[model samples]
Target: MKSSLFKISVLIGIFSIVIYACKDKDNNEKLEETVLQGTATIYVDQTLQPIVEDQTAVFESQYNVKLNLVNQSESEVVNALLTDKTQIAVLSRKLTKEEENHFNQKKIIPKITHFASDAIVFITNKASQDTLIDLQEVLNLLQEKESKIKALVFENPNSSIVSYMNNLAGVKNGQKKNIYSLNSHKEVLEYVSNNQGSIGVIGLNLLVQPFEDTKQYTDKIAVMSVRNVKSQPNNVLYYKPNQSNLGEGLYPLKRPIYMLNYQGTAGLGMGFASFVAGDIGQRIILKSGLLPVRIPSRELNIRKEIINNK
Candidate 1:
């Protein structure tokens, strides 16, 4: 009777162990399924919000993946990537050597995807006569001892606009007077639209939209052109910011835009990056008066005279 009782006790213990193992396996499978359907958070420069917002809707429809996007300054995005706060970051410029080294030290190989090229455009009220400015004039405007010209920009605390301006103007001196950095591009547009004397500088992505959607805004403000100072010194020949101009390298204010993915393999970052660099992604960029990384084919309209001569 004692031997039979011991066997029963041991069998019961083994049965309980098997049940617990089965439950643990089921729980792990459920967790993995959740991860496969999970959402991805993408942190990007504020200026690229509108561009991405539109692209996200289309990407979701095709990929069945959701993008949880957060808009902030480029600097903020960089900081988040360093802290593992985000998996992907879209920015106007590539990472610096120091930043690259930081990731390398951590054994994180960031995937860089170049999607579009945008030009920083300067605009004044439609009624204002200041249509063109030389690089020297812009430098003086930003660095002059006493200046009254109000230069407007977005509200982000750390913006690439300021740095890009400094590079173009060679303004190593210091902050100039009358630089009224505003809260957002919308506010900058409104302020410049209302005030004729004020000049607004912004990314070209802000102006990209369907012709009907953007006509009202573009009509209110006229974009100014920056001349090639070294090539055309004292001559104020200005080239407007347009898709053709950007492609031809006529826009002096143009800058390359990139998307950096720190989280590798099967993450939301890779999904979005793939979409933006693909054919569809590039088409969207082309619509915005910016140059896409993947060049699109253009239909050349040859005039009858030229065609006949050839």
Candidate 2:
């Protein structure tokens, strides 16, 4: 009887251990299932299309998520977020106060994160001698009713771009004679590349890095410089757009690039938001000739043995 009781107790102990192990295993599997999975639309501005398309692909591959991107203007993207059309938005600027109010009314505070930096580049044909001009000069030329020089923008429907022009030119009366808009940035580039007299105002990311074996974009066009705002006649200036110039604040047209989210912690949007603020992500921005908001310093150590090696 004693032997039988001991056997029964041992059996009960083994059974309890097995049940506990099974429960723990099940819990782990459940935790692993909680991954960022879903379909989300990233409404983007036309200005960021060229750059965002590449970044989105890389991000999707890194994080197992599907991003449905819709190309639109900044204002359009903001409107889409307010209307519950998209969960994420990538644009040049953040939401205005009125847009913020929409989120607040819904008891949600939108998240705004600065990912990378960009510049509004001015490009002119190689034949044009007018390579350097101040913002005042640009304003004067764009606002002058009698000026013969024509200015081309990305799109007429782009209110943000239009507003920038209006603010810079101080156009209270009406639209200027020379200021016009094109269908797309590619169209603007092609038009200005072929026409020696035209000046093309476009986002810098499109033409920053060159293509196979040569400077693809620069072959067709020459980038102009904005004169220094402080110097006399603004003679001293940075001509070409590069990481150094942009990082050092020599680039006059630099703008803070942003990604806005209507909600903070519910979707793949948060994942992307966190990644953009990470070091590896910021490095991608640095590699693109654009300044990263969080700069990282790389330390290289060359040993004496390696130096003596060849």
Candidate 3:
């Protein structure tokens, strides 16, 4: 009787251990399999917020996911990603070597994917008669040299546009007295619209496809045509920030937008990143007036016979 009782007790202990192990395995499997469902926070450059918002809206509606998009300056976005505050970020530029090295130390390989092309556009008040701007003159303005521009307004001091223009003009520190930095892109538009002789530097996405909130100001501002400084004096060509110009590489202020995913797991970040790079997301980009990384194809059927009746 004593031996039988001991055997029964051992079997019960083994069964409990097996059951606990199976439960733990099941929980892990569920966590690993959840791709399109979960919460993810994505930090996006302020300049590209309009388009990113559009992408997020569609993505959230299509899947059981909640995307918290934090619109911030370029520097802030990079900081968030490096600090692990957020696992995903959208920016006009890719991560620097030092940034990638930091991730390498942690055994994480970031997935950077280019999704679209954007342009930096210059806008002025409608009252201004100067409908065209010379690229050299713009560079000269950035360099604090005398130029045709009276004043320049930027979205933010730390924005990608400011960095891009500074690099282009070879400006190490400080800016011209006439140059100014505001809090947001909308403020830039409002200031330019209300104040004459002020040229606003903004992203092309807002002007090309204005959102409801920005349409009022965008309607009041006039987009200026930019002349390429590299072009010969006699062969200088001015291009506008349109889809055709961006697609043909005629726009000199064009920049590529990239999505960086550092989730390091099959989480919602991976799913959202895939969605943005997939067909539906590219179509949203195409409709937003930005140049999608991959142009969605269209099929058309042609009839061999044409009937003309008068």
Candidate 4:
């Protein structure tokens, strides 16, 4: 009877091994990131943090995945993507041809999704009388030419705002002289609010839908409307960064927001890209005081008759 029991136990153990081996191979692979259930790490440009945070919170609540969001400067975000530190990034600009080639050489095709529209914003102390800024004058100041502005404050030197303004001003060297940079956008706001005759350049999202950290500074700083000098002087219009201006392409400082995915498979990046570019994600953008890629359609349900259940 002891020998019979031993043989029976061995057979049962073998059966259990087979059952475990056959069980849900798809769910068992924890290393791979899937569409709805897995892990992912995304690097986001700090300027776009507010809106991305809203999307991330909603995405995490609805899905069974954890997204490690690293908000840093635009250059850092791009470097992380090129060096393969990460396969996904949210940027204020697109990858250059050379940058794209680096990934292509590794047999990874980049999938870029233009999700929303954002712009560079100019702000000043609330007590200041300068409510309008000429884009040309700002560019002139960047080039070290004569300008009305006393000092210009900006976020991190490595941030996208610096790159965008440098490119626009055609300044290859550096914005030294009257230009200064703080550690963060909120610091710039605080500096501008305290300093007289100083202007702060930041992303529009920070000024529009401010996070809790920036809420206190929102009321202290005044957003300046920008006018393009290239337009006829008499008919020039100073336009603020707003939904109407962004949608109609009247905002001169506007830039496109992109999400580049190089996961090379149906990974969590693909899932997030689809989610942000989809109807629901676009709606989130629309409500965040940013311009969505495609406007979310409004549904009107009309019934032939109405019934009062109550």
lDDT by candidate, in order shown: 0.74, 0.71, 0.87, 0.88
Model 1 deviation from native, Cα RMSD in Å: 9.6
Summarize candidate 4's per-residue lDDT along 68-108 as a digit string, tens digits.
99999998999999888999999988898888998889898
Tens-place lDDT per residue, model 3, 1-310, is 9999999999999999999999999777653325798677889998898898999999889887788999999999999988889888999998899888878988987888898999999999899888789989989888888998777899889989999888888896465678899988889988988987678999988677666777778877899999988888697679999889989888899999998988788777778778888999999999989999989888899999998996
| Model 2 residue 37 CA deviation in Å | 3.7
Separate clash counts for every candidate: 0, 0, 0, 0
Estimate TM-scores for all models. 0.77, 0.78, 0.85, 0.87
Model 1 is weakest, by summed lDDT over 10 consecutive residues, at 29-38
Deviation of model 2 at 277, angstroms: 2.1
Could you tell me how far off, in angstroms, the CA of residue 235 lies in candidate 2 after the best superposition? 4.7
Supply the TM-score for candidate 1: 0.77
Give lDDT: candidate 3, residue 130.
Answer: 80
Pairs in clash, predicted candidate 1: none
lDDT of 1 by residue, 1-310 (tens): 9999999999999999999999999777642212224468889887777778777888878765677889887778889887889868888888889878877887888888988887788888899987776655566676764433445554443667776777666675344565667766777777777888677887788766523444566778887877765655555567888877888887777788888987756566776877888888888887766788878666897776644554
lDDT, residue 64, model 4 = 90
| Poorly placed runs, candidate 1 (over 4 Å) | 1-38, 145-157, 170-175, 210-218, 234-236, 297-310
Better of 1 and 4 by lDDT: 4
The C-alpha RMSD of each candidate to the native structure, in angstroms, is 9.6, 9.6, 8.3, 5.3
TM-score rank, highest first?
4, 3, 2, 1
Clashing pairs in 3: none
